[model samples]
Target: MDASTFFILVLIGSAAACLLGSLTGLGGGAVLTPLLVLVLGVDLRYAIGASLIAVIATSSGATATFAREGFTNIRVGVVLEVATVAGALLGAYIAGLVDKSTIAIVFSIALFWSAWATLRGAPPVVPTGESDALATRLRLASSHPTHGGSQPYGVVRVPSGLALMFGAGVLSALAGIGSGVIKVLAMDRVMRLPFKVSTTTSNFMIGVTAAASVGVYLHRGQIEPRICAPVVLGGLVGSMVGARLLPRLRTRWLRVIFAIVVIGAGVEMCRKAIVGGF
Candidate 1:
């Protein structure tokens, strides 16, 4: 494709990915990377770099709304970010040594896993009754606004959650996706936070996680301004629109549709890897 055509397509594709991501609470990077590599014929590294930029843009944009709505648990996000940032730096270094095909295969596996998890639906948020002493001391336990008022929730298994967040960060740097799936799983399931709180907190942390590796990608010259500029702008705009529309949309249907898309992307990535096209 010509430069102008490629730019337009990237803009549109990134916007669509961000819209779907915002609606599904998945973040734009998950969809954007595969779309760029598989459909647009972009190099995996460049695609990942652009997707990371889009992830930071979309996450930062949505985080403002979530925070204002009292859905984000800032304290929890901040505490977990220490682990994530550390892991992200390490993962970025590892990415430099890993083969593109290996990265593609791992990314595809992660996509499939995410699809399966999403398809299974978000498990009911069950409070563990027991709270982490560290969480209590850090005041990570918090409340989020509900229709009636606000409901309080406790944080559990803090160490486990922190470990998982580290893994999430590793995946984020390696695949150039937000790895929100892992973040939400850690907070919502392992830590036993409210669903809304977990999702928003995951969104809150994603930008920082991406930013950590983004510097590495930039230094490596993988982040191209020509590609990242439109992707980031389009992703931000689309995520804003999606966030506005989220309350009115049927999220169950959105999850189903997006799950199919994720599965398709995973299959395509695997095919490319097998064909030596990674």
Candidate 2:
């Protein structure tokens, strides 16, 4: 394809990816990387670099709105980011050593996991009405706006949540996705934060996590501005639109549809890994 045609197609595909990602709280990198690799025949490393850029863009755009609405808990997000940043740097180093097929296989596995989580739906947040000592020390406890007005929530299992955030960062760098699936799991399941807080806080941290590895990718010359430009632009626009539509839509239905798509993407990635050996 010519340069212009390739850019246009990438823009369109990235937009769709971001829209679905935002709606499902998954983030665009999950879909964008696969689309570039399987369809556009891009190198895996380059695709990852571009996807990270889109992740940062989508996260920044969506987080601004979510934060303003009081969905994001800034304190919790900041504390978790310390772990994620360290993990992201390590994951980026590992990515450079791994073969393309190995990355593809890992990416496929992550996709499957993400799909399963989406299908299962966000677990109910059962606040123990008691907070972890660590959480209290960090002041991670917070509240978010609900239909009933501001609802308070307590943070629990800070140590476990931080450990999971580390894993989420590793996955984010390894697969070139936001790894919001794992982030939400850590917050909602382990920390006992409300679902909305978990999702928004995940979004709040994604950009920083991706940014941590982005510098490494850039230094390695993986980021191609030509590809990244359209991906970022489209992702930002699409995610903003998706954020606006989030409150109106039934998330369960969106999750079902998005999960099906994620499963298909996973199958494709695995097929590629099998057919094209390391």
Candidate 3:
């Protein structure tokens, strides 16, 4: 394909990826990563680098709406970020030697968990375990809007939340996708935040988490400017369209579709991991 044609196809694909990602909360990385890898013949390592740019765009673009509406718990997001960022750095370093297939295997497990968490229910209201010193000082606990309406919410295992953030960072950095699902799972299931709060707050942190490692990816020669340019540009346009169309769609079916996609990725990862080659 000529340069112009490749660029155009990438643009179309990225826009669709962003749109799908925004609608489902999977982030564009999950969608775009596979496309760049399986379809466009991009390397998984660099595919991840390009996808990180899109994940950043996805989080930044979507979080504003949630924050402006007074739904996001910025304090919680910021606190959790400390752990996630730390984890991301470590994950990135570890990824340099590990095969991409292995990362995908871990990601597959994370993906299954994310879908289950979303389908099951929201986080609990009561504070379960003791809060960390920093969590107490930060006052990260609060309420969130629900499908029914506004309701009280709380962050359960403050330290565990931090730990989960770290784990998410590791997975995302390794797999080249924003590990928002895992992050939310840590906060919601482990820390026991409400579903809406967990989802929104996780969204708030994704960009920062991805951004933490973007420079590393760039410096390590993982990011190709030609490929990244189209992925980033396409993802942004797709996200705008998805956000606009979100409210009109039947989300239950969409959730199922999203889960299916994740499963597909997992299967691909499993295949590669088991075979030791893609």
Candidate 4:
């Protein structure tokens, strides 16, 4: 395909992916990376670079709405970001040392893991109003607005949550994703935050995490403006729309869609790896 045609397709695909990513807190890169590599025939490194740009755009676009709505836990996001940033730097360095086939295999595995965890879903978390001592000292516990009123919640397992955020960052840089799936899991399941709070906080954190890792790709000469420009523009648009719709939207169906898309992409990527198409 010609450059213009490819650009148009990328624009459309990125818009759609970012829309879903905003709603699910998975970030645009989760879906955009696979689409670029598997459908558009972009190289893995270039695709990852573009996806990181998209993730940053998506987070910036969506986070404003989430933060305004009082769903994002700023303290939690900021605290977790330290570990995420550290891990992102290490992971970006490792990505340079690995071959395309190895990266592809690891990316596919991450996708599969994301799908499985999303599908299985977490059990309902009933806030017990018992905040961990560490969480209290760190000021991690906060409240989110709900239909009835402001509902107070407590944070738990601070150490475990930080550890998981570190892993999420490593995967995010390695796979060119926001690693929001793992971030949400750490906050919602391990940290015991409300689902809405976890997702919005994860969204708030994505841009910082992507920013930390993107420098590595830029220095490596993997980022192409021709590819990244349209992706960022499209993702910004989609994420804004999704953010506007989030307050009233029920996310049960969104989770299913996220899982299906992730699984399909993982399967296709696995096939490509097996066929030596990396």
- Worst 10-residue lDDT window for candidate 1 reads 124-133
Model 2 per-residue lDDT tens digits across residues 1-278: 89999999999999989988888876798889888988898888899999999899889878767777777888999999999999999999999999988999899898899888888875765765568788898887777777798788889899899999999899899889899999999998888988878888898899999999999999999999889989988999888888889889888888888888888987988888889833
Once all C-alphas are superposed, what RMSD does model 2 give against the true structure? 1.3
Looking at model 4, report the run of 10 residues with the lowest lDDT sum. Answer: 121-130
| Ranking of all predicted structures according to TM-score, beginning with the best and ending with the worst | 1, 2, 4, 3
The stretch of ten residues in a row with the least summed lDDT in candidate 3 is: 121-130
Candidate 2 regions exceeding 4 Å error are none
- The whole-model lDDT of each prediction reads 0.88, 0.88, 0.77, 0.87
Give one digit per residue, the lDDT tens place, for model 3 in 136-190. Answer: 6777767665568766655556787788789889888877778887887777677
Model 4, global lDDT: 0.87
Write candidate 4's Cα lDDT for 1-278 as tens digits. Answer: 99899889999999988998777655688799899998889999999999999989898998766666788888998999999999999999999998888888888888888777666766587765679899999888888888899999999998999999999899999989888888988998889999888887888888999999999999999899989988988999999998898768987788898888888898888888888897
In order of appearance, the predictions have TM-scores of 0.96, 0.96, 0.88, 0.94
How many pairs of residues in model 2 come into backbone collision?
0
The segments of candidate 3 whose C-alpha lies over 4 angstroms from its true place after superposition are: 118-134, 144-152
Q: Which residue pairs in model 2 clash with each other?
A: none
Question: Considering only N, C-alpha and C atoms within 3 Å, which residue pairs clash in candidate 3?
Answer: 14-234, 15-234, 15-238, 19-238, 156-191
Candidate number that wins on lDDT, 1 or 4 = 1
TM-score of 3: 0.88
Return the lDDT, model 1, position 120: 82
Q: List the residue pairs that clash in candidate 4.
A: none
